[model samples]
Target: MDNIDQIVDARGLACPMPIVKLSQAMTGMEVGQTVEVTATDHSFVPDIEAWCRKTGHQLIEVNEAEEEIKAYVKKTK
Candidate 1:
């Protein structure tokens, strides 16, 4: 999407690491700011969905390419 405030490249990282790095990156962001995360883990979709639900963040979109899964999340909390 447009106007993304931060991007977390979690490619090559496994389950928890991708989420962990995403969380860390989101920690410094302000409310309404958007963070785009690119990960290679197949579990990132569900993991990030659950995380967004639990943390009150808005999961804007998720895109899967040949080698990566990209997720756009907006900080709401």
Candidate 2:
């Protein structure tokens, strides 16, 4: 997890909540930093992907378990 700057737990929240929290957590990040967002919402896979695509961030990886989903996002530009 070298170069990972922050971790955001967005479990229990839905929709825009996770995105909002991720946005806040990334507010102070310098360009090229990474954020790991762990979510309990299964749909977060596409949600986060769309968010990253729209925001110009990079989705490093996506890992999903039976009860949770984890997205590794990096600020690209």
Candidate 3:
């Protein structure tokens, strides 16, 4: 929350949309910059983690609520 450089609001989106937005946001982000993505998809948590691992980014944290999930990713490369 404090150090996040971008917030991608993918709350209403379905599968893969949130990840798409996050990937796009990462395109122009500087190394070490962070992006927060909020989504309604429960699968977003694991999706983001896998994405981070595949992309070589850092998965800072993930917070999930009843209605939504939030993921923080930091660009590492």
| The best candidate in terms of lDDT | 1
Error of 3 at 34 (Å): 0.6
In model 3, residue pairs whose N, Cα or C atoms come closer than 3 Å (at least 3 residues apart or on different chains), thus clashing, are none
* Model 3 misplaced stretches (Cα beyond 4 Å): none
RMSD of each: 0.7, 1.0, 0.7
lDDT of 2 by residue, 1-77 (tens): 56778999999898879899999988988889999999998889899989998998999999999999989999876
- Model 1, span 1-77: residue lDDT tens: 89899999999998799999989998999999999999999899889999999998999999988889999999998
The per-residue C-alpha lDDT of model 2 at residue 77 equals 68
N/CA/C clash count, model 1: 0
lDDT preference between candidates 2 and 3, better one: 3
lDDT of 2 at 43: 80
TM match of model 3 to true structure: 0.95
In the range 1-77, model 3's lDDT, one tens digit per residue, is: 78989999999899889999999999999999999999999989889989999999999899999999998999999
